[model samples]
Target: MTDPDGPSGTATAVPEPPEKAAGTRGRRRALRHPLARFLLRRVLIAVLLAWGITVVTFVLTNLVPGDPATANLGQRALGDPAIVAQWRQDHGLDKPLPQQYLIHLGGMLQGDLGVSQQSHRPVSQDLAETVPATLELAGAAIVVSLILGVAFGVVAALRRDRLPDHVLRVLSLIGISVPTFWLALVAFYVFFYRLQITPGSGRIDPGLQAPPPVTGLATVDSALAGQWDVFASAVGHLLTPALVLALYTIGLLTRFTRSAVLEVLGQDYVRAARAKGLPGRVILFRYVLRSALVPIITVAGLAFGSLLSGTVLVEAIFAWPGVGQYAYKSATTLDLPAVMGVGLVVGGVYLVINLIVDVLYGVIDPRVRLQ
Candidate 1:
């Protein structure tokens, strides 16, 4: 740069080195990558949230009336002070609350979820064995819900005030209103007892040998192991419970999807597309549905996350050996470590699903990325 008006002197400006400029540009690019920054922020927040959950769960579980040591000892050892004291000491339950929490947190960080007082096995191991069953059930339910819900929603939106729309609305209301436990029982009685169409409560037929456990998801593990008979049996067993779980979610998604699609259909671009003599199906799907998907996706993700944690009743009714069932058992027995483990796992699952949904939002709508 030259300052011509100052002392009649000419000044030369030196350019920054190319490597330095390149490095700055690289840093900027890294910072600008939408998902990288978004994921980093989300992960940091998740870490803090997870720690908070652990602390709260620990405190609350400890505050329950019955002691873990007493619960572990059962009625036989309840009057025996020496045995109960020894059990507390052995399980570190006799320590101060703060000390116990610190110990628990440290062990959690090291992937040790503590041994279940009832099972005498690691809580982590129990979760590993059970979580996949819940995942399988939830995953199946959500898939069914999405497919049926979106389809019904689109049809309802297109029909608007027609008979089909009215019928779907009524059906959705019933679906939402019906209690899951009742539905599971009714389905079991009708299909399994009377009609003998669907298999009874279990992950597989009793007589048939189960496929070797690979993923803990019977249907998946069976298929992966090339056990066709096991796969069929598992699918039959999974359908009723998964469908029962799906019904409520289906209602929610259907209502939300219909509303979103209707809103999108009323938008200027969608109207313009229709006015341009585009094929009705093309305009409906390409313009209307695509525009409507953000809210639908958001609801779906949340519903799926909720399903993952809220399957206790369904799992119990169906006798599905999932985390929800394990959680129920743990809670009932006042199994502190097992309950805490389930809480942490469920919270983590919800956080992860939300994170994925947020990333998907940016992908689906670039404006979200900028925001």
Candidate 2:
């Protein structure tokens, strides 16, 4: 296209309206902001992953070899065809798989996770009741893992080839090798049974009533309510199981951090910092740790996801009323709705953790945002 010629024979172009120019500039600014682009990209990916999770959860649950009506209604109800048919119809099990999936997905979109066949209650409701406990336990475990793992890992790296490094390596290996269930049993037996140092099973003392269900986390709720006795009991009950759940992750992070720190330590910048007479602590923290954060964050996020999902054995051992125990019960009774809800929650947890890790990456290194 050619520009129109003015009366003076000079080429002339029409100017954009002020509003249009302002809008264009705004769009350009948004596009130019690396953080905005990075976040938008990640958010879009998260949405796609979440959609895929719903599909996979629905398909896998439906594929299990059991009749929902039969499983929910029990053997006595099996004799009555009318009752069975009603149950199946009520739960949408009587429909075609595609139709059933559509109905299930629609309900999920509306925050309705369907009724749990085993509990005869909405799976969302059941999850609300149980998920907080699991979150509490997982949160504690991850915190413990991060602190001890990073500390021990950094120490081991600094003292590489020394006795402390060798000992920590051995301990981490043992932690990684030991079975969760076995470790839980031994911890329970030693602390609660033999030594009586920790409370056995349950979230709080059997005698004291649970605090008001504000957050579903006993310690937090009790403390919020100024019920220190309840809070203490909650902590007492929490420590053993949290420690048990943390062991493997702690070991995993220890090894990962050690490797990352070692790699960072060997970098030229680190050597340059040392040669410039920088304090050891400053070099380690400002230079070494900052450079190594990307990998550590990645592993920590994954470890947190594992802690959330793999609490089944620990929850059972501790008799903790969390998603893990709920999942075990749902699976045992073939409660497809409940199982799907659990699966979706687990998938969401991982996605959120990953997103947080990605955001941290951008914050720790500006290059990540550009990518």
Candidate 3:
């Protein structure tokens, strides 16, 4: 052949294009930062999961027995073919399923969540108003649960087989086994109806108007606006439902934390710390608790995410104007757009919580980020 191999009988190496080489170098540089790599990986996974959520919600709503146009139009409007057709066309329900889905996805990307069939307002706007309320409730619940759960868990672990441990274990079992709805009903009856210690249902007293909507959380907004009376009212109104919602999570975290601390207690390093003659409190808090934090954080994250999404029954019972209530209303009314928005919000909550947990893992234990 015409000396294709040249003098050394070896082919020449092909040089990568400058653009390709730059991209490769950029990737390598990005990878060198463990935290950055971890964040990027987590973010990509979250995005993928979000996409799957959209797909699943879309398909399920479509498969469900109901026509959006008919549901929104009512019986009188559905009697008019022209009105029905116009409504379908206006909502893009006239398009092919694939095209409709693409349009829906595109609108979601652009922050347009469609118009709520029930409210006649933008779905995004409705969610914005409701989500903050749920956040406040869920936030309060998580704080209460974390404090009680961690304290009880540590005590249980320390006591091991003593009477305190047995009592706490029984209480936790009751908390876990009891249904939230029934507990909520009983708590509401005993606290609000019988004892009258807590205020009646709703976020605040009807007499005082809500403070300016800086945060949409009544307590926060009231405090920000220097409405101390309103703030106190908001807190009182919030306490009962929040505590009711927290019971299950408190139990779950208590059991899990006990296990985690017990596992850490068995580690060689923990034994070494004890052998070093450290104070009992110091050894327990400094070594066992610190090492057990990663698992505790994981459980807490999942519990918080569940609380945020699973508050429908509690919200309904308490008359709390929150995302859970909104979702329940939408589902009952067959408001598909609002339902989808709620689905997205719930799924996004889990994703964000998981990302936060992952980042916390890296922060608490540097070894986690290396993977």
Candidate 4:
């Protein structure tokens, strides 16, 4: 029905069809699901946490004993006070605290991490180059932790107080007790120096130069460059650090998984699963494994985050070039910007990994999405 007063297109401005209306409502409801809401909240929190990390790092790094510019001058610029002061003014280090914060925040928002006084390179570039190496180490460590840790945990749960369980308990305790630096020292010395077998330290052997950066990770970049020999050397270098990191994490992961799985194993669902005549492997792997996933994921995320900051001793011991090593060097040398940058990035990783873990909760347990 046309109306003379109606605007443009259809004179009556025909209403949406009821079927289409229902479809729109359904789509809206799906978007408004609890999981969707939870994920949205997690994202917001992560952003806030990242900002907080940046702020804290910014403030603390500046709060160090010496001024950024003056300290940067060191023995070289000791003769030129006026030049140092001019440099400080030019870098905005002489600005008021609030102004400095604002400038830093603006820089961050623009993805500019600013320059590192020590390296004379932009912080963003330094991070972009260094992070891949750490990530490769982290990835390998996590893989080892997840595989061996979860496997041992399941074995302990299944075996209870048997020899396997007892042996693992001792191993876990020993792993937990071993200092990172100590383990790394022993591993390096015995394997590299004493035995004269494995390559002692660094990402690659002395004579073997890796192909030009592809992934920035020696192992990955080597593979990409079709240098399998370099990749193999990288793996060997990776073994000690990965094992050290994994051993420490494995104890926590294994113990947590053991308890979680053991708890779920006693649940009625397991009995019902058994009664249904499902194979033992199927029941354990499907029903039990699914239920235990949340706790396992929790530990894995924590371990991964810990590994980022956790590598100082490992890197120092093995001369591995990583973020942890950078932080350690920065701290020892009073390179506040580098130290703070590492802290901010590491803290941000923790926040992001935790968010990812929370998202996994919905995936591993559908009940999280029901509400």
Candidate 5:
């Protein structure tokens, strides 16, 4: 301005300084909605946690008693120093532990899970072939768990102190108390051996020609390939193990859901909805059940994650080719790289599931989003 005070004003309106203008733009660019920021924070934390888990797994595998080279080469090579040395050098086992860890971490980052000492194939490939099997089994189990658990829970809640509630409670208690391995064995004995109603073991009947390995999940791939016989066989083989794995989750979810629904039914809003001439079923489903979903979701997510990793025994019992079975073999043979790979994958699964649950929390309850 030519003068600090003009005729029409005490001071002419000064244009914002370039620095101030740029700063304002920067702040505007930096600002993000609360939900976006929250999600970003969670993702960062999950990444860090996954890395920590990998490191711990690596260290623990290294600390194990057996030498990987010896495990790989066996006693015959143990007698030959040259062979052992060559094996160690070839696999990078000759390097220092920290250097090995770094190399392993780098390879993992690039999606190379290293070669299996026992199988002599890419660990990632092995997991790729097996993980789908586990996923299929776990997926079936979860569906069963959710349907039965929620149904029984709702029935128990509705009937309160009736005979059906008592019977459900008793059954849930038994389900929780029974060991998974024992259940799997008993199921096999009763359903497969004695009754012969289900297939004995494996993912499909050997007599049935398998469909092309499209998804590595026999049932899904067979269905996709229009191979109904293979699909039927896969389903028959899967039923027993899936049911066994689902039982524990069903019990836990049933009890939790029952308690949660009971608590919600006693709430003021639920009673208010009922008093306002709302249909009983509508109030129960829309108000009571929706309010009770948070805990149920939490448990379900955790259960699915657990099923992914904890099905080793069940997989072994059922002879299902899954990551759990692979992990078992690797651990028994002290295959460090394979074991480490499984650990990373399992831990990553758990973290990812928890992240999903957290996101669901925000979606289901807007208050969580605002926070």
Candidate 6:
């Protein structure tokens, strides 16, 4: 538009082309997408959450009653009060809580898990040795749970109120009701003890020569290292404990998926898709499943993390080489370093898994990518 004063002498300038304006609007629209903003906000939230978890975990672990020095020294070291005091002072346990936390935080940031009081070996060494086995088993178990749980759920949705649905619901209810530790014991008895169907304990058969340096996961590293015998042994040994752990996750996820899918099946798009000449299977899988995936993925992710914390009972029952067992042992021995070490591992595991879930959400849903 032009000024009115010089209309006869000068023509007013015209606005830019509509296409350019439209392009600018499109750019702004892309920037303002809910998914993009949600992801940005999520990242900030994750940082705050991680910091909060670290601080709270550190404080709580320290507050847990017991002296690391005494836990190590026992009656002989406690005989001379001066010796116990000296030991505490030497290890900096005598320092103020604030100072101790700062030191621990600094060391943790450097990826240094402090030494175990009871074992006298570095906590990091123990973690490096054990974490992989736990990860392998847990990872496989969760994957299986997700796949089978969702599959069962889809079947139930397809066959609502039918025999298969009732059967799955009953199975899930039983799985959810049984304590994992109790289930592990029963499973061990039935499968390993009575039927000799699966090996009850250990990651691999003793006869199978485990690698010299059991690097990463025994199963994974064995495969990578070309130890097929060890791999077979690991898989066989893993099936029982992994299935035991998987039971609850599968149950929880299946229930969640069934509910979500059933709800989605009632939506308008679902009806419209069916109203079209499209097959029922296409409407269920291609349309309904995509719509249902977000909530199902979320529940499944949280369930997986719960297993990470709650696997202690199962680990103890099965003698599975998991962090839960290590944590339980360390706590019993009042080993501060080991306790904190396992805590870090457990915390980091969930954090990373959650991050992966968020990324996957973006991947599967175009709306998330737009955000």
Order the candidates by lDDT, highest first — what do you get? Answer: 2, 3, 5, 1, 6, 4
Provide backbone clash counts, one per model: 0, 0, 0, 0, 0, 2
Cα lDDT of model 4 by residue, 1-371, tens digit: 12233333542377657786566556567657788777877798888888889888888877778655655676667668888878787667788988988887888788777777678787778777777778888888888989999999999999999999999988888877887778888888888889988888889997898779977889878898888999899999898888887788888888888999999999999999999999999999999989998889988998897777668778778888888777776676666556767877788778878898989997778788565
Candidate 4 residue pairs that clash:
none
What would the per-residue lDDT of candidate 3 be over residues 68-152, giving only the tens digit for each residue? 7766777999999999999989888899989988999999999989998899899999999999999999999999999999989
Query: In candidate 6, which residue pairs clash?
Result: 35-371, 36-371
Tell me which of candidates 3 and 5 scores higher on TM-score. Answer: 3
TM-score of each: 0.89, 0.91, 0.89, 0.88, 0.88, 0.86
- RMSD of candidates 1 onward, in order: 6.7, 5.4, 6.7, 5.0, 7.2, 8.0
- Residue 225 shift from truth in candidate 1, angstroms: 1.3
Name the best candidate (by TM-score): 2
Candidate 5 clash total?
Answer: 0
- Worst lDDT run of 10 residues, candidate 2, spans 1-10
- Compute the lDDT of residue 12 as modeled in candidate 2: 24
After TM-score superposition, the amount by which residue 52's alpha carbon in candidate 5 deviates from its true location, in angstroms, is 1.8
3 versus 4: better lDDT goes to: 3
Best by lDDT: 2
Question: Candidate 1, residues 1-371: lDDT per residue as tens digits?
Answer: 12222322221244556786566556667767886677667778888988888988888888888767656676878788998888888889888999999999999999999999778899999999998899999999999999999999999998999998999999999888998889988988899899999998878999988888887889988999998998999999999999999998999889999999999988999878978999988998788887788999899988987676558988988889899999999988888889999988888888778888887787777787766
